[model samples]
Target: MISRDCLQQSSLMAYKNVYQLLGVAFIVGLASGRALKADEDASPRIGIIGGGIGGTSTAFFLRQLYGPKLTIDVFEAQKVGGRTSLIRVNGEDYEAGGTIIHKKNIIYEFQDKGMAFTTTEDMLRAMGDDLLNMTRHTMNESLQHIGLSQRFIDEFAAAAVKDNYGQTLNAHGFLGVVSLMAVEPDLWAIQDGNKRMAELLLRESKANLIKGSVNTVALIKDNLGTGSVSYELDYTKATPGSDKETSESREYDIVVVAAPLNEGSKNKISFADFPRDVVTFKQDYHKLISMFVQGKVNTTAFDVGSQNELPAEIISIAPGCFFNSLKKMTPVSPNSKPDTPLKPEEAVWRVFFNKDPTEEEINNLFVSHSDLRLVDWWAYPEYQAGADLPPFMLYDRLYYVNAVEAAASAMETALIGGRNVALLAYNQWHGHFDKIDEVQLPSPAENEETKKSEL
Candidate 1:
């Protein structure tokens, strides 16, 4: 039989080889582990847009590090927490964007900072109160076949787990790389990513949060005659298509734009206008329509095996060969489209599609005696190859912390974007680190003791 020690040793060796191949010789350790000079004396005003996971995490981390001394304010267009928000399908709350987390990640952060989490326990509770309860798989096939930025693949692939916020591009240099490999991804592949993200957001640090919309516009050159920032912010939504939502702008000593780059940071704040900031990337987003139905929607069998016993998580809203839950929805309530609208309990297994198909064809894919409901979400980035990506770069004051910036790859990207931008902003403000400094990664706490007490 295989031994755990041997497996760990093999994993480490593989990761080391990855680093060497990617030319990341500078990253000697897992994290940069650099200590930051406290910004107890400096304060900078900040502005923001988008209140997704990235933005929220950014806001959380910023407040954690600079709080009272640093006055930070945020403005979001819609609801807070962005894509990490929850959706109600059949009366149970499910993650509309990010849905999974890993245990090793929790160990990583705890070992580094002596921090613990309640959410991990909550997730574990949902999984039989055991970290090992989650299923694991190795994705050699996806990696072998997945397309990605050559530079990114080169850098990340060197690590044991190479992850890109769902970014890939064929290389003219390494074109025609065959897509054939055995896939057996373990739980760590996804969990570690999720685990680290949760730790960073719920940091032992304290943070302040504000919500609202920010209308960005164009900026004029500083014409020093009698005026300074020439273009005035459009604080009124009086016009038909004006973009600015309100006259709300708070002050912050330092603001790291966690979301995409909009015209606001460019000195354009429109009150009544249309959002015009667009990225050149092929960003496209899709609206998700989820329908939930239980109790076997149709007489035909949808799953590969019997439904006598199955994990609730298997009823996901994605496409899979065996555990596909999208098998057409059944209408349990007969109040009828003639009497009233459908309800959540009427649907059990939820399915999402980019476009709405008729109920006739959809009906053929379900088990009998099920319920149905629909939910629409502006899934990030729109579609593959960048169809709906907005300017996740609103200068350096805000971050488009949804799947849009990192693309709707996972909840981890949305969460990580927030932490990444906050660190970048903090480093720049303290003058201890540079935003582009490749090696200036977040340092592990000085030690477990120091980390625990710092909070």
Candidate 2:
């Protein structure tokens, strides 16, 4: 079925045809944005897959670059925003997976929103006395009190200090080495530890999003005579199909791919091998389950999982499992809310566990006590090993841009990477271009299969 957006596209009418149809050219005149007929022959056709930030921004910018010299259509496999996802559940418009931004993330601070979006600094400035804590004492930004109970705070702090290295050690073979490396908590860091982890996969994990699955499936060129490319999309969450079941396709003179590297790994949706980039990911990406428990009192994050129940303010650094918990907790005392006599729903005490979790073990880990009840859970793959934007031309028109192979996986980094991909495509099409380096992610047909299941 055609979408409601049909009002947006108009069948192209030639220059003289307009005057011929209207029976007047001088009157319809030079003020019209129309170009002379000779310009028509040069218009390029372009198509895109994955309507996330990368795709959307590329379209918007492409319009700016080409004006009436080109036509572009984006073929998305899911909602408009790709990995920077979003959702509405139970009437609570909360982000599920990708969320949060730092003040240093200037790229987001200046994007389409125009208004400087909220940052960690924005929250602190809003609090009058809270500002006092920040100014009155020299404090580690990560260690600031976030409405954690003294008990939780102590536990979290102690865990952070451990030399456990947090690496999974249960591997049995060559894959085991990577599985172990992939699971190391330090690898998720934006610096030296797992610097590439953030560059390749973690960036999207930091954006505000309502997470869900999405994919792009290429099909036999629908407009082969017109030199076009298209895709068969399964938006209703259908199981993927083999060659015979494929249908539909988008057409383009050039295709710039700027989505994550997707191979046929248990974690990836695309089944074919990418034509470029041959390095294999350590393992199929793993799943991440996060428990965002909203209410708790006297339980400082540092104490929740640590041996000492110190005041939250005393912890040297924040725990990795938590997402600035103070935001989840309500400021009023638990007895103050009208109907429920709410507790600290404002503190955002949370934890992330991966595929290695034994069912009984994680259940015990998330079980909320009187001081804390597990209120929310976000389960999804911990995006890893996404490859970068491929070269400008794929068979002269097919372009690939995936984000799993960067050195740091942050939202801004992905956006920058995406911009690079879009610019590369634009230049190769006609505009001034730069030499974008080529990086290849995984593909199912050309690589080993991962053991992960959809569940």
The local distance difference test score of each candidate is 0.36, 0.34
RMSD of each: 15.0, 21.1
Q: For model 2, where is the 10-residue window of minimal lDDT?
A: 11-20
Positional deviation of residue 11's Cα in model 1 after best superposition, in angstroms: 29
- The TM-score between candidate 1 and the true structure equals 0.51
Q: Which structure among the candidates has the greatest lDDT?
A: 1
Worst 10 residues of 1 by lDDT: 174-183
After superposing all C-alphas onto the true structure, candidate 1 shows an RMSD in angstroms of: 15.0
Error of 1 at 282 (Å): 4.7
TM-score of each: 0.51, 0.45
Point to the candidate with the largest TM-score: 1
